[model samples]
Target: MMKEKGLLIVLSGPSGVGKGTVRKELFSQPDITFEYSISMTTRVPREGEVDGVDYFFKSREEFEKLIEQDRLLEYAEFVGNYYGTPVDYVRDTINDGRDVFLEIEVQGARQIRDKFPEGLFIFLAPPSLSELENRLIHRGTESSHVIANRVETAKKELEMMNLYDYVVENDQVKKASERIKAIVVAEHLRRERVEARYKKMLEVK
Candidate 1:
């Protein structure tokens, strides 16, 4: 029997929605089996960062060539630097029967959806707009103006929840992590995923 292909699990949300925090929590769990997809970037590695571990560092020309070749699943430019997921890595990992998890921005998630509609898309939403705004303010890393702009953008992103297969609310970091894990478990057990395995068994019998 052929081995089942693994899932492409995407987790995305608006800025200041604690996506990083929730992802860290989820990955810390021993039971989590998905491999994190390392993104490629055209930027200098920060101190203590390692290539192929932190990010697959690339030159602007090299990265652009990848774009031209359509080797990237999704990519975006921010502050003159390009960051993206490599299509080959994702495809190879899943084909090897190892799930690949992507933690990315809302726009990047949309891009992934376009290319991989069969992948599981989960929208990480804040409990409320006011709560989201408050979390942004508490972070104290951005200017008040920047915070306001992010809140507005988050409102627009929230509307995109309809595009996702599941919505996991960020009520608490632990709770959100638990919910996401549960979703992944359920997705693996979905009928469509298991039907082929069962059918192959019957054929062999």
Candidate 2:
């Protein structure tokens, strides 16, 4: 039997859209074995963020060197912070026939979508701006100014939803997670690509 091909799934969403919760759900059932592609960033790790787990934290100089060496598969600057996807990890995972998941912002998503046109992309969206605001406020992780800015930014992000291959409304965690998982399962069963290859074997001798 031929080895399975790899899938590169790009996860994009606004800041307060509960993308992380849905991602946790997507990985919970163990049906899909995907490596969480670790992103390299110049930004300092947040409180409780672990090295190599939350992100591949690097010094600004080191990140610049990587950029200069063309070692990044996709990289973008957001609000004065640098974020990049290392090519080696992604390349290795894909070669191993394991799907890789990239959780990035809209700009990075656009870059990836353009580079790999066939890559599967899903955008998580809040049910409404009000609900998004409520969730952000309740998180209690940011100050009023940051919260206000996030809300304003989310409006712009939502406007770009059409660019994604799939838009998942992330309101109730359980429902949204199932919807995302359904996409993966359905993709596995899609008949267009693999069917043709299997046809030769199944044909009459």
Candidate 3:
């Protein structure tokens, strides 16, 4: 039997939505088999963030050079920093039959959609716009003005929810993670994903 290519699962949403939180929760599960695709970034690493493990930290010049070479699967500029996925790593890993998960912004997710239409795209949505704003404010990492700007940008990003294959509301971190896992399981069982393998099995007999 031929090795089946792995699934590319993208989790994205508007700014201030709990995408990272939900992704972290999902990976914490013992039975999770997906490989987390480490994204490359030009942003300064936060405290205790290891290079290559948390992100492939690069200089702006180096990141731009990769962009010019088309070596990135998807990339976007956020807060004056470049964040992107490495194309070769993702391709090779998926070809090896290990599902890859990407937690990224909506803009980067859109780029993935254009390049990998068959990939599973999950949109993490807030319970309400007000709730999203509250979450952003509670984070307290950004100034009030920055938070306001993010809220505005989130409004526009929310409109792009139609581009995703599934919408998981981040009302609660654990519940959202559970819903995402269920979606992945369902995607694997999708007829198109498995029919070809079954057909080949019957033909062999």
Candidate 4:
């Protein structure tokens, strides 16, 4: 039997676009190929965050060593802290016939696209800027000033939507989730990805 080729799915969007909520629903469906990548970080563990669950929680020195050794597919410095995606885990998981999903900002997505041109890019866009701003305000979890900053950044991020391979409008939860599921299923049957596998499976020696 031919093994399934793994996919690198990149999810990128501004905050309050409902990417998290929609992705949660899709991952819960269990009808598609998706894996949450555990990112490694040098930041201190936040409240209720397990050592290896929310993040790898590595020491700054260790993270730098990995960067020096070129063991990271991508790494970034945010607010004086370091975070990165380990290359080995991604390579191994893909070789095992499973798809890997990366949840990152637009910058990270761009970097990955530059390296892996064939990777799938999906952007989750809010129904409207007003609705997205409302979500930020209604969230009520962050300070007004912080929310404003996030909204400002979100507006800037929206400009990059044209660079994505797929744009998923997250207006209605059910409809958006269905759209994402269909996108995954369709990509799985992409000629290059499935053609070789089917050929191997049908080959008679």
Candidate 5:
């Protein structure tokens, strides 16, 4: 049987919507096979963040050079730092028949949509704004002021959820992960992806 092309799955959502948690759980499933796309950034590495594993950190000059050379699939500036996906890495992995998952924010997801319209875009959503605020506060990683800022940003970003192909509410981590996994399975079984494979067999017959 001919192999189908790999899927490019983009996960996007507002800040503190449990996207990272969902992604973590999704990959833990034994049947799910995918590669995580490591993003390149011009920001300083946080404590304990490894160079290539956590992120591929680059200097501003190097990042700008990449932009000029069209090496990035999509890029954006946040908090005065540049973050982008390296085009070659993603392309290579997908071409090798491995699904690639990009956990990104809304703007970066939109850019990916433009570049790869056929990609599967899933939006993660909090159950409610109040719940989202509570989770952010409970984490205690940020001050109240930062939590407030994140809440506001989340509200604005949530408005764009309609743009995604699927919206999964993160009421529970495992449930959300299951829903997303189902979507991935469904996408792989799409007619367009399977039609060519069937045609090749029929031609042999």
Candidate 6:
């Protein structure tokens, strides 16, 4: 029998919804093999952030060139910076039969809906909007103004949650990750994902 092709998992959420935390937890699982799609950005690197690993830092001109060449899978401008997923890496990884995970914002996710409808889209949400604000405040990384802005942006992003195939509430880190893990497992067993592989095997006989 032909082996199943890897899934393209797109994870998205509001700014303070802890999607990254859950992604990190998911990666810790030994059996799940996935390659992360690193995004390219026109923003400057922060302290201790490595090039190509944390983000592919690019000049505005370089980023624009990629856009012109249609090299990006999905892209959006946030807070005056350009951010996009590189198409080549993600395509190659999935073609190689390894799952690829993309952690992106709602705008980028919306774009993906058009380009990659077959991919599994999961939305990570906070238990409540108020709780999302609290988490942002506790982080102490942004000014009150920025926090308020993020909260407002999150409220808008939450409205788009219905667009996703599944919604995982990030009330607790571990629980959320487990829910996502379950989703991945279920996706693998989906009839559509398996039907083609099995069909090919039958035809060969």
Best by lDDT: 3
**Which number leads on TM-score?**
3
Stretches of candidate 4 exceeding 4 Å from the true structure: 129-158, 172-174, 200-204
lDDT of 2 by residue, 98-132 (tens): 78988887788888888778778998887776566
What are the runs in model 1 whose C-alpha is more than 4 Å off? 129-157
Report the candidate with higher TM-score, 2 versus 4.
2
Each candidate structure's TM-score, on Cα atoms with residue i matched to residue i, is 0.82, 0.78, 0.84, 0.77, 0.81, 0.83
lDDT of 1 by residue, 1-205 (tens): 4678899999998778898789889888999999999889998999988999878999999999999999999999888999999999899999998899998888789999999999999999877765666776588767779777777767786688978999998989999999988998998899978998678778888
Stretches > 4 Å off in candidate 2: 129-158, 196-205
Which prediction has more favorable lDDT, 1 or 5? 1
The total number of steric clashes, by the backbone 3 Å criterion, in model 5 comes to 0
Compared with the true structure, model 3 gives a TM-score of 0.84
Relative to the true structure, candidate 3 has a C-alpha RMSD (angstroms) of 6.4
Q: Is candidate 5 or candidate 6 better by lDDT?
A: 5
The per-candidate count of clashes, in order, stands at 0, 0, 0, 0, 0, 0
Scored by Cα lDDT, where does model 3 land? Answer: 0.89
- What are the RMSDs of all candidates, in order? 5.6, 6.7, 6.4, 6.4, 6.3, 6.4
Which pairs of residues collide in model 5?
A: none
Lowest lDDT sum, 10 consecutive residues, model 4, at 128-137
lDDT of 6 by residue, 1-205 (tens): 3656678899998888898788878888787667788889999999988898879999999999999999999999999999999999888887777889999998899999899998899998778765666777587766778778778867676677878999988899899888877898898888877898889899888
Better of 2 and 5 by lDDT: 5
| Candidate 3 Cα deviation (angstroms), residue 107 | 0.4
In candidate 5 the C-alpha lDDT for residue 161 amounts to 87
Tens digits of per-residue lDDT, candidate 5, 148-171, equal 777786777668886799988889
Q: If the candidates were sorted by their lDDT against the true structure, best first, what order would they fall in?
A: 3, 1, 5, 6, 2, 4
lDDT of 1 at 97: 88
